[model samples]
Target: MVWPIDLAVLTLVVMVAIGSLMVKDLLGAAILFGAYSFMMCLLWTVMGAVDVAFTEASVGAGVSTVFFVGAVFRTSRRTRD
Candidate 1:
Protein backbone atom coordinates (compact mmCIF):
# COMPACT_ATOMS: atom_id res chain seq x y z
CA MET A 1 0.00 0.00 0.00
CA VAL A 2 2.28 2.76 1.27
CA TRP A 3 5.27 1.01 -0.22
CA PRO A 4 3.88 1.27 -3.72
CA ILE A 5 3.30 4.98 -3.38
CA ASP A 6 6.80 5.46 -2.04
CA LEU A 7 8.23 3.48 -4.89
CA ALA A 8 6.39 5.62 -7.42
CA VAL A 9 7.74 8.77 -5.87
CA LEU A 10 11.24 7.36 -5.85
CA THR A 11 10.84 6.46 -9.50
CA LEU A 12 9.69 9.97 -10.35
CA VAL A 13 12.66 11.45 -8.53
CA VAL A 14 15.03 9.21 -10.44
CA MET A 15 13.43 10.10 -13.75
CA VAL A 16 13.73 13.80 -13.01
CA ALA A 17 17.37 13.33 -12.00
CA ILE A 18 18.10 11.59 -15.25
CA GLY A 19 16.33 14.30 -17.22
CA SER A 20 18.30 16.99 -15.42
CA LEU A 21 21.56 15.26 -16.27
CA MET A 22 20.65 14.70 -19.90
CA VAL A 23 19.40 18.23 -20.52
CA LYS A 24 21.86 20.30 -22.53
CA ASP A 25 20.70 23.72 -21.38
CA LEU A 26 21.92 24.64 -17.89
CA LEU A 27 18.85 26.69 -17.05
CA GLY A 28 16.48 23.97 -18.19
CA ALA A 29 18.39 21.41 -16.19
CA ALA A 30 18.21 23.58 -13.10
CA ILE A 31 14.46 23.94 -13.53
CA LEU A 32 14.12 20.20 -13.82
CA PHE A 33 16.18 19.73 -10.69
CA GLY A 34 13.90 22.14 -8.86
CA ALA A 35 10.86 20.23 -10.05
CA TYR A 36 12.54 17.05 -8.86
CA SER A 37 12.95 18.57 -5.44
CA PHE A 38 9.30 19.55 -5.41
CA MET A 39 8.28 15.99 -6.25
CA MET A 40 10.52 14.64 -3.50
CA CYS A 41 9.01 17.07 -1.06
CA LEU A 42 5.55 15.84 -1.94
CA LEU A 43 6.75 12.30 -1.46
CA TRP A 44 8.05 13.19 1.98
CA THR A 45 4.67 14.62 2.88
CA VAL A 46 2.98 11.49 1.68
CA MET A 47 5.30 9.52 3.91
CA GLY A 48 4.19 11.48 6.98
CA ALA A 49 7.32 13.64 7.30
CA VAL A 50 5.87 17.13 7.19
CA ASP A 51 8.90 18.95 8.59
CA VAL A 52 11.29 17.25 6.19
CA ALA A 53 8.95 18.01 3.33
CA PHE A 54 8.77 21.66 4.31
CA THR A 55 12.51 21.99 4.45
CA GLU A 56 12.95 20.23 1.15
CA ALA A 57 10.30 22.37 -0.51
CA SER A 58 11.79 25.59 0.78
CA VAL A 59 15.48 24.87 0.48
CA GLY A 60 15.52 22.59 -2.49
CA ALA A 61 12.82 24.20 -4.63
CA GLY A 62 13.23 27.80 -3.55
CA VAL A 63 16.83 28.39 -2.50
CA SER A 64 18.49 25.98 -4.87
CA THR A 65 16.56 27.30 -7.87
CA VAL A 66 17.57 30.85 -6.99
CA PHE A 67 21.23 29.86 -6.70
CA PHE A 68 21.17 28.04 -10.00
CA VAL A 69 19.48 30.95 -11.74
CA GLY A 70 22.05 33.32 -10.28
CA ALA A 71 24.84 31.16 -11.57
CA VAL A 72 23.22 31.07 -14.99
CA PHE A 73 22.93 34.85 -14.94
CA ARG A 74 26.60 35.19 -14.11
CA THR A 75 27.40 33.17 -17.18
CA SER A 76 26.00 33.60 -20.67
CA ARG A 77 22.93 31.61 -21.69
CA ARG A 78 24.58 30.62 -24.96
CA THR A 79 26.90 27.63 -25.04
CA ARG A 80 30.42 28.27 -26.27
CA ASP A 81 32.29 26.31 -28.86
Candidate 2:
Protein backbone atom coordinates (compact mmCIF):
# COMPACT_ATOMS: atom_id res chain seq x y z
CA MET A 1 0.00 0.00 0.00
CA VAL A 2 1.12 3.54 -0.67
CA TRP A 3 2.04 5.89 2.15
CA PRO A 4 -0.65 8.42 1.26
CA ILE A 5 -3.48 5.91 1.41
CA ASP A 6 -2.24 4.53 4.67
CA LEU A 7 -1.95 8.02 6.08
CA ALA A 8 -5.45 8.89 4.99
CA VAL A 9 -6.94 5.83 6.61
CA LEU A 10 -5.01 6.47 9.77
CA THR A 11 -6.24 10.03 9.80
CA LEU A 12 -9.82 8.92 9.34
CA VAL A 13 -9.54 6.39 12.15
CA VAL A 14 -8.12 9.02 14.45
CA MET A 15 -10.84 11.50 13.60
CA VAL A 16 -13.56 8.96 14.22
CA ALA A 17 -12.01 7.95 17.50
CA ILE A 18 -11.76 11.54 18.62
CA GLY A 19 -15.34 12.20 17.65
CA SER A 20 -16.50 9.14 19.52
CA LEU A 21 -14.67 10.22 22.63
CA MET A 22 -15.80 13.80 22.47
CA VAL A 23 -19.48 13.15 21.90
CA LYS A 24 -21.65 13.63 24.99
CA ASP A 25 -24.38 11.28 23.86
CA LEU A 26 -23.66 7.63 24.38
CA LEU A 27 -25.73 6.55 21.41
CA GLY A 28 -23.95 8.93 19.11
CA ALA A 29 -20.59 7.79 20.39
CA ALA A 30 -21.55 4.19 19.85
CA ILE A 31 -22.55 4.91 16.26
CA LEU A 32 -19.30 6.76 15.62
CA PHE A 33 -17.34 3.91 17.17
CA GLY A 34 -19.10 1.50 14.85
CA ALA A 35 -18.16 3.73 11.95
CA TYR A 36 -14.58 3.72 13.19
CA SER A 37 -14.67 -0.04 13.22
CA PHE A 38 -15.95 -0.09 9.64
CA MET A 39 -13.15 2.17 8.48
CA MET A 40 -10.70 -0.08 10.29
CA CYS A 41 -12.24 -3.08 8.57
CA LEU A 42 -11.77 -1.39 5.23
CA LEU A 43 -8.17 -0.75 6.06
CA TRP A 44 -7.78 -4.39 7.04
CA THR A 45 -9.31 -5.52 3.78
CA VAL A 46 -6.94 -3.30 1.87
CA MET A 47 -4.10 -4.92 3.77
CA GLY A 48 -5.30 -8.37 2.59
CA ALA A 49 -6.71 -9.47 5.94
CA VAL A 50 -10.12 -10.59 4.77
CA ASP A 51 -10.90 -12.78 7.75
CA VAL A 52 -10.01 -10.09 10.24
CA ALA A 53 -11.98 -7.55 8.30
CA PHE A 54 -15.00 -9.84 8.30
CA THR A 55 -14.74 -10.36 12.02
CA GLU A 56 -14.34 -6.66 12.70
CA ALA A 57 -17.28 -5.85 10.47
CA SER A 58 -19.50 -8.41 12.15
CA VAL A 59 -18.42 -8.00 15.76
CA GLY A 60 -17.36 -4.40 15.97
CA ALA A 61 -19.94 -2.90 13.61
CA GLY A 62 -22.88 -5.20 14.36
CA VAL A 63 -22.61 -6.78 17.76
CA SER A 64 -21.03 -3.84 19.51
CA THR A 65 -23.60 -1.44 18.15
CA VAL A 66 -26.40 -3.65 19.43
CA PHE A 67 -24.78 -3.90 22.81
CA PHE A 68 -24.28 -0.17 23.08
CA VAL A 69 -27.82 0.64 22.05
CA GLY A 70 -29.20 -1.90 24.45
CA ALA A 71 -27.19 -0.46 27.25
CA VAL A 72 -28.32 3.02 26.40
CA PHE A 73 -31.96 1.95 26.44
CA ARG A 74 -31.50 0.28 29.78
CA THR A 75 -30.14 3.53 31.21
CA SER A 76 -30.51 7.24 30.50
CA ARG A 77 -29.39 9.32 27.54
CA ARG A 78 -28.49 12.39 29.59
CA THR A 79 -25.04 12.70 31.15
CA ARG A 80 -24.00 14.78 34.14
CA ASP A 81 -20.66 15.73 32.75
Predicted structure with the largest TM-score when compared to the true one: 2
C-alpha lDDT values of all predictions: 0.90, 0.89
- Please give the lDDT score at residue 26 for candidate 2: 86
Model 2 clash count equals 0
**Tens-place lDDT digits, model 1, residues 1-81:** 288889988999999999988887889888999999999998999899999999999999999999998999899556431
Q: After superposition, how far is residue 60 of candidate 1 from its true place, in Å?
A: 0.5
Off by over 4 Å in 2: none
lDDT, model 1, position 50: 94
CA lDDT for candidate 2:
0.89
- The TM-score of predicted model 1 comes to 0.87
